[model samples]
Target: MLKLGVLASGRGSNLQSIIDAVEAGELSVEIEVVISDNEDAQALERAAKHQIEAQYVGPEDYNNNQDFEQAIIDDLERNDVELVILAGFMKLMSPYFIEHYQGRIMNIHPSLLPAFKGLHAQQQALDYGVKVSGCTVHFVDQGMDTGPIILQAAVPVKEDDTEESLANRILEEEHRIYPAAIKLYAEGKLEIEDGRVRIAK
Candidate 1:
């Protein structure tokens, strides 16, 4: 089974989905640890509920960003994590960290990607008056949300949709596709060719 180390900064709804999938026997993976930059992140609480090892690695405890990232890396390595999942981790990873886990990290973003690449993606889509909006699961590269796409699910933009409404719908798709993407990785059914992801038979 694939061993995952998850990093999150907030409510951890996505983490909950993964836990649910694992407990339901729908995903063949082990959440080895949950680490959060925020001390009060509800993700830790969720991890505790599931009896998974959870830790808080605040950046303030380190002298520099590199050191902070190294602390995270040490924790991940200690747990023998094969894959790292960013479940709404608010900070942008430094190149030092990205290089260490190249092609071994995954993140879910709320947008079609290559469209609204950075934060508040739902608001960006609504502000642009797009007819369609969705979420993307992708490999985590050095650039912000510029990684090769693994999976995406589209949601039609309703005429009266607010940012919150659109985000809620997009999050549903996020919960669905993120785990599916992880499953693909776990099954060795994902391949990267050129600059894109190619699913295997």
Candidate 2:
């Protein structure tokens, strides 16, 4: 089975979705551990509920960004983690971490991506007055959310939609596609080529 290490900083709803998929036999992988930077993050609770190993690696414990990421990297290595999924990890990864993992890390963004690339993406879509917004699953790279897309699911914006409402809708899609993207990786179907992702048939 593919071994995964998940990083999150919030409620971990998406992490729950991934756990649900594994239990349902939809994804053939194991979540070796869930690591969070925030000690009080509900993601830790979610991991406990699943009986998965959960860790809190606070930035305060480390001297710098590299050391902080190194702490996480060490934990992941100890767990034999094969894939790193960023469910809601708010901290930006250091270049050292990115280079070490390279294409092994993935993230799900709450925008179509290449569109609202950074934080508050749903609000960006709403502020731009767009009719459609969506979620994107992609490999994690050095840039903000500029990674090559793996899958996208769009949600139409309503006239009365608020950021919370739109984000709720996009989150549903995030739960769906993130597991599917990880399934693809576990099946050895994803290939990176020239800043893009190719799914082998």
lDDT of 1 by residue, 1-201 (tens): 899999999999999999999999999999999999999999999999999999999999999999999999999999999999999999999999999999999999999988999989999999999999999999999999999999999999999999999999999999999999999999999988997999998
**Lowest lDDT 10-residue stretch of candidate 2:** 61-70
Best by lDDT: 1
Candidate 2's clash total is: 0
lDDT of model number 1: 0.96
Q: Cα miss at 63, model 1 (Å)?
A: 0.5
Candidates in order have lDDT scores of 0.96, 0.95
Model 1, residue 91: C-alpha shift (Å):
0.6
Model 2: how far residue 27 lies from native, Å: 0.5
Per-residue alpha-carbon lDDT of model 2 for 7-112, expressed as tens digits? 9999999999999999999999999999999999999999999999999999999898888999999999999999999999999897899899999999999999
